[model samples]
Target: MYKIITDGSCDLSTERAQELDVLVVPFYVSTDGINHQKEIVELGIRDFYQFMIDNPKVFPKTSMPSIQDYLDVFGPLAKDGIDIICICITTKFSGSYNSAMNAKNMLTDEFPDVKIEVIDATVNTVLQGMLVEEAVAYKQMGATFEETVAYINKIKISGRIFFTIGGMDYLVHGGRVGKLSGIAAGALGIKPLILLKEGEIFNNGLTRGRKKSKQKIVEQIINIS
Candidate 1:
């Protein structure tokens, strides 16, 4: 049998993970001003989103998991004769992909016969989760590991995610936007359309107000959908 591994960046819900029997390796999110660190999954999405809202000054920074964390998950599953295929966030976006690869190499050395394949999702959030769901479906249909992997890569290319953020303050603090742009938007009360491309944040444009911002987001989603 094959077991699946993925990271918190996929934004897969807890219920979905449980139902799919997917193992989630968490990534750490930290704030510069506060020592309190949280995993993306440990803090529920609603709570995490609210935290981001309330503590706009924190400037969230994300970190990849330690290799030991991966070994702990992969080593035992390998020992138990279950092959592992880990789907990770894009290397372009996070070091978590590299971390998963390193863990795969280490697991190969320790459990030479146990198969470990690390897939680059190339996209994150619910899209990645959808890819995982497809993989799970393939497995259930008795597709080989190689076939399941191929399906995931194809899905990665076609998937898309788009949204808008009301606050540019966080993006500016995270160095994603220039101070001048953020300040000007604050002065003018403009909201920016945010698009997720290649698993990272990209600015679409500024909107005059929240209603326009939301309408723009809806249009973007309709176009993409």
Candidate 2:
């Protein structure tokens, strides 16, 4: 049987991961950027956002999983000879793809018979989760490992992730605010809507306030559709 896995960037909950029959390697999150906790697994969403709001001095930091993290999951499954398809967030946004690849390489010589493929999802958040679910469905339908990988690659071609930052602290700290790179993100009422297409982040346009942020994302989706 083909096994599907993804990183925390997929925005999937623990229950959702269980229901989908997919393994999720959670990203490390921290308020101090030193003491880290696994996303959802150790850190809850409500607490994370609350910390962000309560402590404006420091934004919550997100760290991707390491090669060993992937290996821990891969080693057990590969030993059993189950084929694996690891779907990771876009390489541009995160190093999850590289980490997964490194883990696969380490085991290549050891488990020559076990098939292990790492996919660059070219997307993030719910879109990334969607890719994992698609793979699970394909497996449930009896698709082979090769066919599932092909479907993932084919479907991600048209995937586009549109979003609006309710808060820009994350982007500012990430040092990839694009056109607004050097500007003060919190200054004024400038709410920026962004897009993720083809593994790159883009500053689509500016909205007015917090309420308009979600509306802007929806508008972009409607326009695209």
Candidate 3:
């Protein structure tokens, strides 16, 4: 059987995660000087999101799961004689992809019998989740681990992501945008319609306000499709 894995950055919920029978290697959520790399299933999404909202200043920072974390999940499956395929967020988004790859290589030395493959979906959020969801269904239908990984690669190449940030604070803080751009945008209340292309976010354009920004998103999607 094929065992699937992803990290918290994918934003997959517990119920959906369980239904898919995928292992989530969580990323760290450090806030208020506390740090944890626990499972998202354990943290609870509603409460976590609420915590972020309640303490807006305490922006949660995420980090890749440690190598031991990957070993813990992969070891059990290796013992069970299952092949592993870990679909990860874009390396461009986080270092998680490289971490998983390095861990998988080390595990192979210990469990030569178990096959481990890692695919960088080159996407994040719902777009990444959609590929993972499809991979789960394919595995359920008896697709070999290699086959599912190949399918995910195909989907990744065509993935479409459109996003509207309520504010550019996160992007600016993350260094995804220039300080001047963020300040200018805030001054004009500009909403940028962004698309993730080739593992980097590019501004599709900007709009005057929230309503127009949303409408512009709709228009862009229509034109693309």
Candidate 4:
């Protein structure tokens, strides 16, 4: 049997992961100088979002999982003679992909009989979750490792994501947007449209209000459809 692995950034719930037999590697999130390992099995989505709402001044800092983290999960599975398909967030956003690659390379010599394929999912959150689900479906259908990877590559380019943040402070603090742009947008009650394209995040457009932003997102979806 093949095992599907993903990082916590996929926004998958513990129950869903269990149902699909997918393994999730935890990433680190720091809030107000305190570091917490974000494992969906331990932390619910509501609680995490509530913490973000409560700590407006302190933007949570997220760190990619280390190579050791990947090994901790891949080693035992490799030893068990189970193949693995690891889907990681976009390389542009995190080093998790590279870390997984490093782990795969190191384990190759020790576990030459096992096969591991690491994919740069080039997406995160719900979008990433959808990709993981698709991979799980392919696995369930008994597709070979090569077939699954090819299917993922074919569909990965077809997905597009658009989102609006509640506030710009976090974006500014993260250096995702210019400080002046954030300040100006806040003053004008404008919301910027952030899109994930090809593996990179871009601030492509702006809307005058939340309603307009939602409408713009809907229009884009309709157009894509």
Best by TM-score: 4
Minimum summed lDDT over a 10-residue window in model 2 is located at 177-186
* Clashes per candidate (backbone, < 3 Å): 0, 0, 0, 0
Steric clash count of candidate 3: 0
Give the TM-score ranking, best first.
4, 3, 2, 1
Scanning candidate 4 in windows of ten residues, the lowest lDDT window is 35-44
RMSD of 3: 1.7
lDDT of 1 by residue, 1-225 (tens): 889889888788788889999998987776564444547555675677677788766667777777877887888898998888999887777888888788889878878878888998878877788888888888999998888878887668876777777777777877877999889888887988877766666778778888899999989989878
lDDT at residue 134 of model 3 (Cα atoms): 91
Clashing pairs in 3: none
Give the whole-model CA lDDT for all candidates, comma-separated. Answer: 0.81, 0.87, 0.83, 0.87
lDDT of 3 at 58: 69
Residue-level error in angstroms, candidate 4, position 183? 1.8
Worst 10 residues of 3 by lDDT: 30-39
Q: Which stretches of candidate 2 lie over 4 Å from their true place?
A: 177-187, 211-213
TM-score per candidate, chains pooled: 0.88, 0.89, 0.93, 0.95
Better of 1 and 2 by TM-score: 2
Error of 2 at 62 (Å): 2.1
